[model samples]
Target: MGAVSAPPLFSRDFVDDPYPAYAWLREHAPVHKTRLPNGVEAYLVTRYDDVRSVLADPRLSKNAATSFPGWRPGRTGIPGEHRSGIAAHLLNLDPPDHTRLRRLVSKAFTPRRVADFEPRVIETADRLLDAFGPEPVDLIRAYAFPLPVIVICEMLGVPPEDQPIFHEWANGMADRSGPRGGVGRSVKRVRGYLKELIHKKRLTLPADPVNDDLLSALIRASDHGEHLTEDEAAAMAFILLFAGFETTVNLIGNGTLALLTHPEQLAKLQADAGLLDAAVEELLRFDGPVEFGTWRFTTEPITVGGAAIPAGEPVLAVLAAADRDPARFTDPDTLDLSRNEGGNLALGHGIHFCLGAPLARLEGRVAFERLFARFPDLALAVAPDELRWHSGLIMRGLHELPVRTSSPIRADYQAH
Candidate 1:
């Protein structure tokens, strides 16, 4: 019999529960070609092995200019990236340019730097959770969203007064389904702000020798031998902010929801504090924030999962589906916190693996540890089935996570 027509791909229902469709695709059409809502046609690579291979394939290029010959204005790539002059960052480039930019930024975003920032992450998490009452509250708004926003803001040296403004623009820029005009405006505004901020930092470079923020580091790098252009600097900072916070938001939100739904897993995590790290990994593998790998265009004809993809066509590895492939994982559907397996595409694989993985892990580990420690009796306010997920192909996150503490606390009660 012929292959079954790909189950209604990327619809609202699929957004809410894509696993079943993904399973079907994995079994039947591992390299299924489908048109996205924006009218861009591409091949969706399913299966763990295929997804992993596709992510690292040299023949598949990430450079939008060279690879995406069918690019649609405002519809393809980040909205307004070209017009805002922030399109030259790592994600949109390849080769020597990608290498140079990533190396320069990595010098500042070191493991020691992330470790030093742990106290701040814990402080931010605790502060956000402190405001919660026994009554139901949307975790996304009160906790998940703002925690990372504040962390990234502080790291980027955005002043306290400007944080709200930054958050507004981030929200606007992140809305994948919002009006194109709104996204463009947000991108332009952020670009303008970054340009001005960079200029101001240059003037103070001599007087402000103690400045230690990531933005300051970038400016100094450019002033030194790094040779980074202003546009490149702004673009790198822009991607770092968006990439740093956006995934962590979902990591906390989705991971929390996963534990809340799977009481056994939650109990296991509660029983052993050592499991926090492993639990985060499991949560990421089970339902990571990134649903699909970023777009890659074929530089030459390639066969993925036995399906031939011609040169110049765009391909997306279904990270969500690949992570759940039964063949690659033992009892893949089961959420085992102690279960250890390698090569989950949740954080991605190969050269383009997420640059912010270390920071994301730190935030997720701290967020969950602080949250559960504070609210041991936490329970979902809404039925699990009633929860709504944002309708986007790239990000997998809840619209809101209404949760409440079941126990009454005295005025003197303090979070540990």
Candidate 2:
């Protein structure tokens, strides 16, 4: 047998199916440095242990402001993050600041709160699924995308009518292949809307505002001397909405695809609703929405997977690759709903772990349960090879999932 050749990185083909290349990197060069699409040179860590260590490593800082000079934000950093005043969120800050900010919003996403939001999630999922008839429809547009957007909007106290606006802006920004100028415009629009929304909320807030929604809680915190500024509030809101929905959108989309393609797994899940929670975890580990962890910079010299990295250089831990690492997972490529293994870096690991994870999981479980229950005959409208994936580095998701409730699912289809 010959060694596998290095797969092209960030090309259209690679975007559609990046696992082969990731597998090669894991085997051949676990910590390899290469130029990213944005033209920044960074170390790509592909092993499971290395990714976890790198993510939790204080030497690999998350604060982008201190990155080496001449390094542009490109797709890695949010557009107009500083000028538009949305740069103070969790993704960009290191500790103390990160700790303080996370504390303020932590109450909204606690396990108890997320569990309490279950009824709303089920109602929202059912409402969205009801719109789909027997005819073929793009599930991504009709179901997967809007469910999370609407849920996040509810959590943030945004009016129901404003959700469509959020859907448009969020869709625009997630399209990294779209015109750069267009993405910037979408970012500006979101920032402006958030700033105004914060101002409007502040005026109507009661003497002791109830913490029903996250934004209201943030405003109350700011007013009560938590030192959270107006910009910080807007920044936090922007991050929560943007990060919160996109992940669940992909989770529902990707997990559905996983189930639909893997008939045995699908049947196992269908036969037993009790397996829903474990299935969600397996789905996340099998093909998670997060492809790579957010950009991290080497705060000081460090060694990762035998590769010595210098200070002030960019680094990316391939989350999907790490989750698929053979060293950590048995038959890593196979999707087993009953797989009892843990330690998937899908939401993330350590202090920087995704704050919205509990919400995302609850949403994923409810979304899948409702989706299959509503349309047991649901099957792919197109062949697996014909599907297209989003060409973004940070997240993994399908562009569209055409499905039909009228036709019986094909049993012999190969899993993607």
Candidate 3:
């Protein structure tokens, strides 16, 4: 059989409803060549097995610095000078460096550690919901976006007052369709803010660093030994601030939208709250936050799903596509709350798996539990087709999720 020809991978049609095209690629061109929105030639690994394999393959290097000259990795258009700091994040590093960077903050995000945030997560969710009036509200702005941002901010010791600043910076960086200058400026602002924040935290280092938050711990790590450089520390903070909340924001937004559209599953979850865990997993598998894994470059010629990709070419594992692969899940399109097939790549696979997965899950569970419990008749304010999704190749999130809280609460309830 010959390779399947499809629309540009980053086309609006593909962004709006990529499943049909993904299905075609999976069956006919699993290891397909396509152009990124920036006009960079790349190969997309679309099938479940291949995507899982490519994610863990050492030959597919994450460090674009090692790629052949003239082949730049996919970026948000941040300039090289400003990029060096934030780009030092774990997502852009290969083994050793990647391993080192991940280990520094991994303990803070452990299952037990993340579970510790349950009380705060619930409080934040409820507080946000309480503030919502009876009328229709953009759930993305009112709840999904702020909840995770606040939680992550609290966890990292970022001032609650500065959340608006972080949100502005993050939005600019995440806008892949925006001008390069704008994205570059956002990156610079965030990097500068992190540097100042880290410096301030270091000056006030608590008596026992171990008792401090993730940022303080990172500062201690850099202060004590060669574990992390100043640049790397700031980069780590920037990535955590942006990547941490951004993905969860989408998970909550996308997952909630999914439940709203699938009333049966929503009803099932609302009835038996115990199914929250499985439901969150199924929702992630069905249509999770990340659309594709971060950019990777082939260090050597590699063949995936029968297609040979040359060395130095960029590669991406379409997690959104792989999770819905018919070969992997039964009735892949159906939203099954009890789905136990497991191994969904929504949070990704292998060593570079999302460090924030535990937090994301906790947030999702808390968000859904509080959301449905507070407003049993929660629903979309507009038609399903009227919703707009973010136009980015890496992240899959709704721009705004307008929803109506059917029941009105007393005005005093808003005093939280």
> TM-scores, in order shown?
0.96, 0.93, 0.93
lDDT (C-alpha, whole model) for all candidates = 0.85, 0.84, 0.81
- The digit string of per-residue lDDT tens for model 3 on 1-416 reads 24345656667677778888888888887887776776666788899999999999999887777774445433422344234456778887888878777877664445776777789888889889888887899998889988988887788777878978887777786665577567677878878887888888777776545556777777666323555666777888877777788898899999999999999999999899889999999989999999999888889998888888889888989999999999899999999998899889999899989888888888998899888887889999999888888877788998889999767764454311
RMSD of each: 1.9, 4.4, 2.7
Q: Model 2, which residues run further than 4 Å from truth?
A: 1-5, 73-75, 222-224, 407-416
* lDDT tens readout by residue for model 1, 1-416: 12567789878789889999999999988988888988988899989999999988888888867777797655567778888888888777777788888888887777887888998999888888878887899998899989888998888888889889999998787676578488788988988888788778778979999999878888777424666666777898888887778899999999999999999999999999999888889999999999999878999898888888899898989999999999999988888999889667898888888888999999999999989888888899999889989876677988889999976543454544
Candidate 2 clashing pairs, residues 3+ apart or interchain: none
Task: Give the deviation of candidate 1 from the true structure as CA RMSD.
Answer: 1.9
Runs in model 3 deviating more than 4 A are 1-4, 72-84, 175-180, 206-211, 222-225, 410-416
Consecutive 10-residue window with the lowest summed lDDT within model 1: 407-416
Candidate ordering by TM-score (highest first):
1, 2, 3
**Model 2 residue 23 CA deviation in Å:** 1.4
- Which model, 1 or 3, shows the larger lDDT? 1
* Error in Å for residue 47 of model 3: 0.6
